[model samples]
Target: MCCNENFEERNKGEKITTTLDLTEISGMNFFDPHVHMTSRTTDDYQAMADAGIVALIEPAFWLGQPRTGIDSFIDYYSSLIGWERFRSSQFGIKHYCTIGLNSREANNEKLAEQVMEILPSFIFKEGVVGIGEIGFDDQTAAEEKYYRLQLELAKEAGLPVQIHTPHRDKKKGTQRSMDIAIEHGLDPKMIIVDHNNEETVKEVLDRGFWAAFTIYPFTKMGNERMVEVVKQYGPERIMINSAADWGISDPLAIPKTAVLMKRSGISLADIELVTYRNAISAFAQSGQIDEHDFIKIKDIDQSQKFASNSILRGGQQPRIDKNSIIIS
Candidate 1:
């Protein structure tokens, strides 16, 4: 049973697939500070590495559906550090994670309490980078309580906080997310406020916090909009992410956005600051990242097979290089 059964299952059906052209965008390495790989497939990982995503961070977030027990949180956290990390390495991508009680799920007081008790155990573990993807989901009281608690945890551990502002009532939510972090004694520099739009970027930057924009499809800031953001606010402490998850999202959002910036006359220095340098600086707060680890992956054994694992089933072929010659 290979980890990826989706691609193999698809091959069994009589269907034709078209590959996206990524030839013009090769050789540039990226760090997608945010992604939910648990919701993506192995094929996505292989393509990401091929597209130059050398490392990524997976923050523990609420599932589309709520989790009911502490055991579920433990299992999820374990996978972020264990199976998920291992699987990423298999594709030559380094995986790191952040563990926390996401605001959306904090409404369940009982489970939240249990989750809080076990969080300390995971905080200092290997590959656990920050305390985050935590903050105002609905701006509710329960959300505030857990957000403060996690902020304290981050302060205690000296780890950075990755905040998720409310989708609705966004401006106020983004402001309040920063306010509450400050109220809890977290420095603005230690917080990475994610999913910022034009309405909220100025306030976030003025407050001295790191503003991270997600180049999502349709709904969130697209590359064009993000380029405008770079123009409005120079890329000092700004970063970009795909925040790509179970929804209709793109993992190549970071690089694609960088390309757009380049085409729009943004300098390579500015481009590097947002896409690579910013994320590296933010995650480096964990003191776990090594700058020397950015070298090209060598000797990737595409022909290698895993224990009871293969990228295919029923004698099908494995596409180690998905963007290339499929000599059929």
Candidate 2:
């Protein structure tokens, strides 16, 4: 998710209002290509699986606060490919991630240079689907400097690029992101423009980039608005995501939005296109993922460990009940 200067940290004790009938889209497969699971709990993983999400792509994003040193970025990126991947598998979801210097962090030139150095070591590593959620935050010179560098990285590596359009001046940011990618000699088909809205969809599609909408509760596009976008655009290279993070976001948003798409008379073929197929078609260009990647993930051996650490604690048992709603 992109940074919003107006947003404040909320108290976790506060109640989150959600739609009542999220189960209507059950039994369908979803690929939320922009969720931040590091900030969510095991309970959210269980809920996403219960909602029919077979796999997801967690892109590198701002973590809601400034990370002080290069070690922090290194540790965070390591978790995305290591413990976080293992954790999602324990709960029956295929987790893949994009590796890059995020827009916000790129503004810090010295730290950004250090991050750029470490990126080559990780971008070509396993489970890295693309170089992304990378684009303008405030559209500063430093952001553009590293943005171009990562674009070169993705092209030379033969991986796709996931673009994060800005929260403010979204239309202009979305347009400029595509222009720059094109100018860099990257194919439009290789770019995934995210956080899109009505103001930017047509141009994104016309330019041949995959248009992705974030189904956030208030600040971004909502489920109702998403349905109309599909109705008008007809789901050609268009997909939707939750973008759930350490904010007032919903992890079960794709399923919930599919329910609305069904009730609104959107066809099942169209629904599956936007919710699942489009995501696979886009990121699979990296030759890093395929049909077998997300196939039937369940009944994992929870006894597994990452770097001598287990997802399980002292008295907690491994989860075997897929039908149950709670993770633990």
lDDT of 2 by residue, 1-328 (tens): 5345453454446676764666567679899999999999988988888788989999988888888899999999999999898889867788899999999989999999999999998998887999988999899999999999999999999999999999888888888888889999999999999999999999999989999999998789989999999999998999999999998789989998999999999999999999999999999898888667566445333433345766543223354675589876
Give all candidates' CA lDDT scores. 0.84, 0.88
Model 2 clash number: 0
Best by TM-score: 2
Q: What are the TM-scores, per candidate, against the unseen true structure?
A: 0.86, 0.88
TM-score of 1: 0.86
**Candidate 2, overall lDDT?**
0.88
In model 1, which range of ten residues has the least summed lDDT? 296-305
lDDT of 1 by residue, 173-269 (tens): 9988898888888888889999999999999989999999988877688789899899978999999999888877898898888778888888988
User: Candidate 1 regions off by >4 Å?
Assistant: 1-19, 294-328
